[model samples]
Target: MIISWWKETKSIKEVFVVFCRVVALLLILIFALVGLVELFVYLGIAQDGFIIQRD
Candidate 1:
């Protein structure tokens, strides 16, 4: 029974690692998209009428 329990525990840890990897990947993708948007605005590629003008 002890050996079986150890196997189960290992399996659970493996599943947890996979879950973490997937979540990390999703977060990285989200950050990459945000960075791309920021780059566009920084480079003046996303001009809109909302840009305020002053005398």
Candidate 2:
């Protein structure tokens, strides 16, 4: 279904442009998520690695 839709609707250039846009958005989202995680860790509200407890 998707293949047929693509074949009928968009040209190669249009498909390439769409693919680039999707990739760019994905990269932006990944960076934003990583930045937020780093910010949380920097604020001491989160931690990295394993935590150990001793009695």
Candidate 3:
């Protein structure tokens, strides 16, 4: 199954499209991580005095 899918993406256009999709997914993941960190800080779960300090 994987081999067939790889073969289908042998064309340059298909490969470029796949690359763009992967980059987009990575960007989304990074944004999500940053958002989560911000949320934790806003909730007082993470603070400047310590790694994590509940108020």
Model 3: how far residue 17 lies from native, Å: 0.4
Candidate 2 lDDT (Cα, whole model)? 0.67
Taking the tens digit of each residue's C-alpha lDDT, what string does model 2 give over 1-55? 3543665646777667767777899999989877787777778876742132224
Model 3: CA > 4 A from native: 1-7, 48-55
Task: Name the weakest run of 10 consecutive residues (lDDT summed) in model 2.
Answer: 46-55
Tens digits of per-residue lDDT for model 1, 1-55: 3433544545766767666776899999989877776677678896432233225
Models 1 onward score TM values of 0.65, 0.69, 0.71
Measured with C-alpha atoms, the lDDT of residue 3 in candidate 1 is 39
Using TM-score as the measure, the top candidate is: 3
lDDT of 3 by residue, 1-55 (tens): 3433765776667777877777899999989877787788888897643434346
Question: Which of 1 and 2 is the better model by TM-score?
Answer: 2
Q: After superposition, how far is residue 37 of candidate 2 from its true place, in Å?
A: 0.3
Cα lDDT for residue 3, candidate 2: 42
RMSD of each: 9.4, 6.5, 5.5
Runs in model 2 lying further than 4 Å from the true structure? 1-9, 49-55
